[model samples]
Target: MSQHPLARLKRYDIESITRYYRFRPWLVFARAVLIVWKFAGFLLGLRADRGHTNPIRRRQRAVQLRHILTDLGPTYIKVGQALSTRPDLVHKDFLEELTRLQDQLPPFPNDIAFAIIEQELERSVSEVYQTISADPVAAASLGQVYKATLHTGEEVAVKVQRPNLLPTLTLDLHLMRWAASWLGPHLPLNLGHDLLLIVDEFGTKLFEEIDYLNEGRNAERFAAYFKGDVSVKVPSIYWRHSSRHVLTLEWINGIKLTDVERVQAAGLDISELVRIGVSSGLRQLLEFGFFHADPHPGNLFATLDGKMAYIDFGMMDQLEQHDKEILIDAVVYAVNKDYDHLTQAFVELGFLAAGTDIQPIVPAIESVLGNVMGESVADFNIKTVTDKFSELMFEYPFRVPGRFALIIRSVVTQEGVALSLDPNFRILEVAYPYVARRLLSDESPELRRRLLEVLFKDGRFQWQRLENLIQIAQIDAGFDLMPTAQLGLQYLLSEEGQFLRRKLLLALTEDDRLHTDEVRRIWNLVKGEIKPDRLWGAALGALATVWPSATALVTAFTPSEQL
Candidate 1:
């Protein structure tokens, strides 16, 4: 057999591609000309149709754009996938069509796939497995998968890379980078980012996806994060069988999450899976800071045991500890409708430059986010927020950072998956509970400050927000009111809580009289949720810690005013 084209290429990096493709200028130029010709034609057509708001015209343009990307091959298909998630970078109609860019392509011949797989594993195909599928199970831009049974009687999915994928992708990326360098300044795109940076980010992630070992490690780390969670499932990677060009892992048996009929037929509750998806997605973003950036319906499935199984860990992203805290802070600011802080959060998150003028941006943030504050949680939709923010992006210099692009994609794709199952599904209904639980349970100083921001404003305690948080948090099975109350008490008695202490005293006193009604309301909300014994015990423990202020604390809640 001929030596595998990728055998000598152990790794891929955008920075090194220029060195490798320097002699391939003619090939790059030819491909660049082809791409420019296709897009230039599309633009000319778009210019003619700019005369009216015709839905049919818009859709036609969208489909044409999708077809162009599909016809351009794997690298462009990957670029389309990234653009599909970036509403800030693409028109809404085009973005919709791009989402339909299913990375699926015709499978390469099985002989070629098997030959490559055997070469990577360095063994005879017959000796490695008890039984292997004669045909490819699934095919995508980069690789195709086959179902095989290991000699140990374990069922596994074997993924084999397409022949010469690295050369094809690397050449395309190098050409695209050149095209962007030449044409970026002339393009009308106002994404507030360097066009080449976007290309580099995409190139880096694409290279990562082709490396099966990197994907296997991503799977293990993802599994470790949810080790004890029974509601989520991650496939066990078989490293001994996996290689740079091939991956083998325990096969997951389940219906795709979007297959509502099949899932219901399997006796699994679709609503429960949606809840699991929301909560799990939250933990990936807000807690672990690592998330599956590509969570399309095909990558998510519902198992027989009612757990959500995550597959294809090839495209995952991580957030720094500080980024996670900033995200949580942004959520708190949005809930409080503190546009100033929200604007600041945007700056910290790289959405805006540090020294950029925030005056114009603050109201824009409010206009998009503030509108949702009035809607009931059950009525709130993430799609609505993203759609409006898409508009906000054009009106200002706001840019979706390269990292944030994946974060937005993961969230929006998760929400899109949920909506496919239930039209009445409101992501906020499930998401707010997770946020509330995180606020109540996490003792991190960042979250503590955020929680305080949510429960206090203008030197007055916001009793209603606290009560609402408790009510919403109880919806999550993982939330325990006793421990939450203990944490709250602990924070209140600590040095940091001194500010809250002063605010609590002021809120309680009106004309030198205690205002007990708000406290009563909170008690009523918690009474049914917490066991009386645990609640009282926690209360006693807190009181013991602050014995000196015990009498005053009790008196503040005593009925001394009209109520």
Candidate 2:
């Protein structure tokens, strides 16, 4: 058998090796060694300054680590933040602590920043901009943002990469690869996916982030996805003045999403913001499969007109279609508290490897969810549930796929922002309706078959699916009527549609007929309107009358506040 080209053995290119040597490989090595050497002293000081057992001391230590990582420049801060998401690599305390590991620094001088822009664009700063801020609006490990006005008079936020950032970060990645190679043998669990795999994935994502052109395309792609959406916003990029080192985008001035008091003071509904945030995030994850991987509060804002504008397109991720299906299944199973099905989803999704003992995994998941979600699944908190579950799953042969790690982190962060404003907000309750709508609209033959198998158990349609559908429809207000009605009409007005509709109605209604409440509601609507000579649309009128669920379904399709 032939091995795959990627899997085949290959020789190292001495030219590339020598190129690294030429580009100050010694400097990278020295910097890495110096950082590691300093780490020993850091550990000693870390212990001497605080007690590990005390919560206050631990928090103080966490803060110390946060500051240390931030000061370590872009690579360390980025690597620390990346590893913080993986439960297998770090503990819950460190994970929570690392969340405070902000990527910020004193802005490098204005001259150097301007110099880089001029060099990249091949034009003087005066030619590129009418006026550029001498001081940066925000500075971070990798880049700084400056408010600039283009010669064409468009207000823009110009992001400038730090001087020599790539060379430094590239060297740090080499050190990381070396460290991962060293750590692989010492790990107790035979993790199918090792540190090398994680580092490689991170390297690809980081490389993408460093390329401003890629960031520009990501912004355009995301904006195109939500082009007409009034609730969501992605700033347009001014690519004429942008490049690998600098990204210029339309300036978005809005209140930070985390500043709840000010947002409320500005007369925007905090709860509505939460709903929009969760819904939009889910659509990216479940529908588009491309998401802004870092949707932390700082990267999000509410415009003066209440639009949720997203910035920072550097760190983005993609969810494959196969993964999306498994995720959808996992969510639905979790919502139903069907741990067995959830385990099945994990196995199919390759989170838990095949042939592994799933018993321990199944009940463990069930216990965690039961404790976190409580008896009422609809009222479950997604952030708490996922956090607790992640902490538990690390014990098993469970791997948080790279795609899901970012998605989970982004969502958990958003949940914190949402909870800060509304204590009663339930993300699952807001998201489940979208799940149902997706299920209903899915045209895939496989999904259709699955739906039939699950809902049409024992030969006829099970009324429970109808009940659940109604329940989900009532909760999701984004229900669109015409297209859904068109699909239903195409199906119902067809031979198969008519057959399935009658069969479902027969299974749901009493003897395939309307009940007293249904009859009364129908009579109340059409008592005086129905005439002896006019019987137009009588079948739909009767269908709506006979089934309360159908009435709710039609109401879902109609234009209304909560439809």
Write down the lDDT of every candidate, Cα atoms only. 0.85, 0.74
TM-score of each: 0.92, 0.83
Q: In candidate 1, which residue pairs get closer than 3 Å at backbone N, Cα or C atoms, i.e. clash?
A: none
- Per-residue lDDT tens digits for candidate 2, residues 423-529, read 88788877778777776656575555455555664576655554575457546676643344345445565554565777657654756565455445535533454
RMSD of each: 5.0, 7.8
lDDT for residue 239 in candidate 1, whole number 0-100: 91
Which parts of model 1 are misplaced by more than 4 Å?
1-7, 14-16, 370-374, 530-532, 536-563
| Candidate 1 local lDDT, 1-563, one digit each (tens) | 67634346656565567876686688677887888898998999999997789998999989999889888889989989899778778988787788789889999999998888788899988888789998988999999999999999999999998898877888888887887899899998866688888788788888889889999999999999999899999999999898988999999998998778898899888888999999999999989999999999999999999999999999999999999988877776766567998999999998887899999888888887778666566767777888888788777877888888888889988999999988888887887788889998887888887788787777677878888888888888888888788778977887778987888888788457787988898888888767756766677666666674784576467565411
Worst 10 residues of 1 by lDDT: 554-563
Best by TM-score: 1
Off by over 4 Å in 2: 1-19, 22-25, 41-61, 189-191, 444-447, 457-460, 481-486, 492-563
